[model samples]
Target: MLRARRWSTRLFNLQRQGRMGTTAPIDGEEAAVVGSAAAMDPAVDWAVPQYREPVGLSRFGDRVLLHTILYHLGHPDAGAYPPDIHVFPTQISIAAQIPHAVGLAWGLRLRGEPGAVLCYFGDGATSEGDFYEAANLAGVVRAPVILLCVNNSWAISTPVRLQTAAGSIADKAAAAGIPGVRVDGNDVVAVREATAAARRRALAGEGPTLIEAVTYRMGPHTTADDPTRYVPPEELAAWAERDPIARLGTRLEQAGLWDDDRQRAAEEDADRRFDAAFDAAQATPLRDDVFIDTAYASPTPQLERQRRLLHDERSRGAG
Candidate 1:
């Protein structure tokens, strides 16, 4: 998982260099994101991420090149519910994907599929109506889902203080009559254990669990953001002391799982892999957008006309 953080740093640099489009930086929340994902079984668990979960997706698909393509293009079809995976396409809306994740868990329970769903969202998403509705329904139906909210201090530019008066986001689970847990988001072991426990409860038909990971966003919200404008320099410096990688590195060193030599080799390998993947993503041919095939069944006349217009627009752009 620390390796993933390293790769994301390079990816962020690429985005900064204008080799990519929009990106949501996941620098400080790597443990919260990757640790939770590492606990999920890709074969049966499902993840609905809100634009900032590439590290989690890496747990499911180690195909760095494919993920590179997905991130670089940011195409609609790229996230159109790809087949047979634990993760879905990156969500764009604030909290809209929460309901979809609840329904997925509910449907899986209805079909007796024994599959659980994991949903990721930021602190700001909690203020949205969709979040409450989805939480209520998931609790009522005992949906097998784990709602992992990464409360990374700030939601874009809005800080958590302005978003909710509650002491902790995890406490919100009580309104739905489910378990809520607060963990040190920087502690990878703690996050993993919490997720594993939640997964077990879900599989046992114990309903959903809401987890609030208390972490800080050590960097800008995204490539488009300028943290220096709003975030305090001292605040960033304070969180720097709680760096998840550094914390995890100490643990690994004690366990003999890591050393300076191993760390150096890992960093070099990650850079090499990312460079290759970036080049491959650039070289791979992109098929023209086909809006007509988006609809599963028959399209109405108006829909067909719209699709034609979109296709024409894309064709013109390509030409």
Candidate 2:
């Protein structure tokens, strides 16, 4: 979680400097992401994440971070992962990944594979129709999937109250006829335990579980957003008091498991990794017309003509 926080900070700065694209900061939501990820067996379980989660997905593999850097660099291959990487590409479309996750989980079950799919989305996604359809199907099919709703209180600029009328995000799960759990998102241990319990239930042939991780987003919805406009100063301050990293660090220190030296080492390691990944991303050669090449296995006549036209235009411009 500390590493994720540090990396997110650097990524945010990179965006400000115009070296990277706009990114959603995982500032206060680190524990919710890292804790649930910690509960999964990377070899068996699959992680389907929305855009905000790559930094916190290190539990899956180092490649997740590497690909994240590439993604921020706007590489076409950013979505391409080698077979061993168990995470799906970060989906920018709201709630679209939910149904995909359900499909993946159902496919696994049909094939007699052993694993559950962990789908992470924000509370805002629950407002979309895709969430309902996916949840309903998962329940009916008894698909091994966990719907983790990271309710960070806001969806871009829209507050949770404006997004839903439900008392809590977890309450929506009842319509799907599945278990709903609300956990303290700031508490890493609680999130981990809840996720582990959900995974066990799924593995035991129970239906999907909806976990509402109630927390607050400490930063803007994205680099393009200005939270100061809508978020009240006092409310922000109140949530700041519950910062997940500090809360976890305090507990670990009290248990004698953490020290300043260890903290510094982790920060240093995170910096080194961010630097290395960014450097590699920048060093990668640009692949011209990569979208055209990858769009179809066999390009139709019109697409082939379009590709040629694009190449010709580039060639003429170069000359």
lDDT of each: 0.82, 0.93
Return the lDDT, model 1, position 181. 98
Full-model lDDT, candidate 2 = 0.93
Tens-digit lDDT string for candidate 1 (170-190): 989988888999999999889
Which tens-of-lDDT digit does each residue in 84-125 have in candidate 2?
A: 889999899999999999999999999999999999999999
User: Candidate 2, 44: how far from true, in Å?
Assistant: 1.5
Q: What TM-score would you give candidate 2 relative to the actual structure?
A: 0.97
Best by lDDT: 2
Give each model a TM-score: 0.91, 0.97
Summing lDDT over every window of 10 consecutive residues in candidate 2, give the lowest-scoring window: 284-293
Q: What lDDT score goes with residue 25 in model 2?
A: 95
